[model samples]
Target: MNIHSVAPKRPDLDRLLIDSALALFAERTYEGTQMPAVAQHAGVGVGSIYRYFPSKEALGNAAFRYAKRTLLDTLAEALADGGPAGTAREEFARFWRGFTRYASAHPDAFVFLEHQQHDTFLDPESRALADELHRVAADFIERGQHAGAIRDGDAEQLVGLALGAFTGLVKLARPAGGLDALPAEDLDRAEAAVWDLLHRKADR
Candidate 1:
């Protein structure tokens, strides 16, 4: 009996493969990574990978979706309350903190997500999930704009700017050993700077 030909019977094994793939993808990027490397990293045979994912593209898409879903799930609780009356600023601040914390705690996932741009292998579900996340962010920006809190502009563009800024901050902080490496006061200052960029002049 060839064990390599058999699919992993345990869900945890699937998670292990996904997690291993995420780390490799984060370090080497999608194009640079290979299934054999991922299998080796996961301590599984190459055939085991194919048993779970038909091809390298499929595995990449699966890993991307896993990381994305994990991130969204992490934020769900923090964002559950939604924006209450007269609390747009507070809500945004809470969301920003939650996002930064998650990224810091899960650098591999964050890096993998940040690296996904113009990847043709991403499956339909992955693309849809990405679109949904963007829509959520754009909606938040639109709400802030209407409430006279955020700067007036195209909501999508504003979201891009905000996300770009956050991404850049994470990249810079990576050298310093993640967001948590920064002092609490420093994190606060960074968040304040981000808020200032988003805040309308009238609100400021």
Candidate 2:
């Protein structure tokens, strides 16, 4: 058996190959990247990549899943440090801003994640993971509603709205200046705008 073919069976090789695939996908769009390039970048044989991920799409899915996990972990840390979920609008804004900054700085990673939802190449497991992430977001929205922080609405619908706003803000901030390109005053204003949308005064 070839060393490359055998390597994929090793746990470490799986991570190594996936990391390389993601890096290439980040730099190049899905259609533009090839398995060979990923293999080369990973310092493994092309066959090795195949052993773990049958196709480029599968590889892309794995990369995207990794990125999502990483982003959520970072968000969790920011939220933990900022304050509890009840009344930390400023902290939440700060976390959102930081998350946006991270995404802008890692456009390749972000684009890979955005594309994952539409990619037909993703395996069943990867698709399941993506669906679970969305469900978790919906659950969080429901929790907020229960806490009297959010307006009464379908949690799933509200999640979609919140994500739309989040992504839209990132896009708006991208060209004029990356997330951090905005001055302190501008960021402050943006932060206030976000909190205002999420936390309006309760209707009598």
Best-fitting candidate, scored by lDDT? 1
- Candidate 1's residue-wise lDDT over 1-204, tens digit each? 666786667667778999899899889988889999999999988999888888988888888888888778776666865555356678777678668867977899899898566367987899998888888778888888888888888888887777788888889889889888888898788788888888888633
Model 2 TM-score, all chains together:
0.70
The TM-scores, one per candidate, come to 0.89, 0.70
Instruction: Give the per-residue lDDT digits (tens) of candidate 2, residues 1-204.
Output: 656644345358888887777667756866678999988988888899889888777777778778777766666666676456545354456466556655766655665675434455767777787777677666656666676776777777765665666666666766776566767787677666655665546778
TM-score of 1: 0.89
Candidate 1 residue spans exceeding 4 A from truth = 1-11, 81-85
The lDDT of each candidate is: 0.82, 0.68
| Alpha-carbon runs more than 4 Å astray in model 2 | 1-20, 23-28, 37-48, 88-91, 94-98, 175-177
